[model samples]
Target: MGTRRPNALQWVWYTFGGKLPAHLSEWVLHDVTCRTWVLRHFLRALTQLAPFCVVVLLLPGPLHIRLSSIVLGLLVGLFYSASAMVETNEHRLIKHGYPPGIGRETRAIYRDLRRTARDEARRRRGWE
Candidate 1:
């Protein structure tokens, strides 16, 4: 029997929050880390900001106000994209061959290693 392919709606749902099927999980994770994923999110943020920019440009207002509105809209869109979409991004990272808490553990290890090296250097210099 042929394997069934996911449909468009399924893809959207999975991208948002739906459970990824076992067979496609690896492929999805790889796709999420690829350059295409970054481009897709960048375009998504731009698309979200585009309408606001157009509206602000069309509004009857002083140039400074319109420019400020455009800037505000861009900031809001970026904040929304980063905050609201973090869950899905984290989920993808976790699935992409990274263990849960790997980021935290790695950071802690690096911090400790750097501290130890710094202390050793200071001791050698008679500063500790």
Candidate 2:
């Protein structure tokens, strides 16, 4: 993790596809590849979906209809967002000057680390 990070405004800007300053590249890398990357990606998707959700709410319709539309829209939006989570993170990394596929590689390395740690713990407990 990097000591330097973007402020709230800069974070929102970055979440919406704006690039942060070069100095924050390390933070950006961590943001997209850390253990909480999935939650981070979903938060970004929600931030991007919020406006459209409000618009759906405002559109003239029956109460249930408008609310249902918002729900369905969000479900669809999140579906697509989840589908592209890896690519999206990779793109963010690229924008921060990381080579392509770093996100995937980083996540894989973390997964292996977790698996190794789990196996070690299991062995010590005589459960493996």
My TM-score estimates for the predictions, one after another, are 0.43, 0.91
**lDDT against the true structure, each candidate:** 0.64, 0.92
* lDDT tens digits by residue: candidate 2, 1-128: 77999999999999999999999999998898888999999999999999998988888879899998889999999999999988888999999899999888988999899999999998999963
Residue 61, candidate 2: alpha-carbon lDDT: 74
What does the lDDT read for residue 4 in candidate 1? 52
The prediction achieving the highest lDDT against the true structure is 2
- Residue-wise C-alpha lDDT for candidate 1, range 1-128, written one tens digit per residue: 12454577766656454665667655554444443555656555676568779988999979999999899889887877877554555555576445665434544566688799999998999963
Which residue pairs come into collision in candidate 2?
none
At residue 74, candidate 1 shows an lDDT of: 93
For model 2 the TM-score comes to 0.91
lDDT of 2: 0.92
Model 2: CA > 4 A from native = none
